[model samples]
Target: MFAENKLTDDMAEIEAFLVRERAKVLSEAEWKFRMRGYGYNLRRTNGGVEVARLPQNTVLGTLAL
Candidate 1:
């Protein structure tokens, strides 16, 4: 028991968003570079490597090196 028209409109909006922003999507490296300016760093984890945001003071001090 559901409204079919409501579901159709929701799906249409999602499709439209994907189509419009398809070209604006960033590559993995691009994303890393962009976020790096905000104090994020890549680190090794038990499972795999991941990017994390460090404390502002610590990041700034490291960058001064």
Candidate 2:
């Protein structure tokens, strides 16, 4: 576990974060690239937040290709 190894604290800050992030218009090509790379679909919600939904059955890992 991360805590056992003291790798990170319970309230550690994330590497890339959004502090009051505003949504920017993304073109079709840009959107597709984002989806393929991270499996996330982004859309503007009524609440003014860029909602990103992850695809199902998608698992993330680090392995050599």
Candidate 3:
């Protein structure tokens, strides 16, 4: 299938794109959190678990996992 044709290089490219997208999500979450208060942040680690003071931002972060 299409998956087989995707070389390791192609796979790496995809992963990079995904990571960039995930960073975007995290930035958005951070913005939302900062809007409400200080000393709060929305962040997602490589493990895919999102720890955010805003709470609901964690739901979208599962995709990064």
Candidate 4:
């Protein structure tokens, strides 16, 4: 039916939005990791993904150094 089709379309749209948001978060995380001397890890917990910063050794912080 038309309603079912509409529901499917809406779900697809929502999924696309979520994917874009996740990509944005990942891009920002990568930028921080590269530009700043930060390490990160993505973990799945409680049915959601979490971005966590990891501790780094003082001697090997950045790529340039």
Using TM-score as the measure, which candidate wins?
Answer: 1
Clashes of 4: 0
RMSD of each: 14.9, 11.3, 11.8, 16.0
For residues 18-62, write the lDDT of model 3, one tens digit per residue.
Answer: 455446555666543432352223355677544332323322223
Please list the residue runs of candidate 4 whose C-alpha ends up more than 4 Å from where it truly belongs after superposition. 1-9, 27-65
How far does residue 21 in candidate 3 sit from its true spot (Å)? Answer: 0.4
**TM-scores of all predicted structures:** 0.32, 0.29, 0.27, 0.27
CA lDDT of 3 in candidate 4? 20
The residue-by-residue lDDT of candidate 2 on 1-65, one tens digit each, is 12222333222221122111112325645643544444333344454324233555222221111
lDDT of 4: 0.36
Where does candidate 3 stray beyond 4 Å? 1-9, 27-65
lDDT scores of the candidates, listed in order: 0.36, 0.31, 0.39, 0.36
What ranges in model 2 sit over 4 Å off?
1-32, 57-65
User: What local lDDT score does residue 28 receive in model 3, on the 0 to 100 scale?
Assistant: 66
At residue 39, candidate 2 shows an lDDT of 37
Q: Among these predicted structures, which one has the highest lDDT?
A: 3
Tell me the lDDT of model 2 at 30. 62
Q: For candidate 4, lDDT tens digit of each residue in 1-65?
A: 01222422243443343344456555745644442332334444564544333453222111110
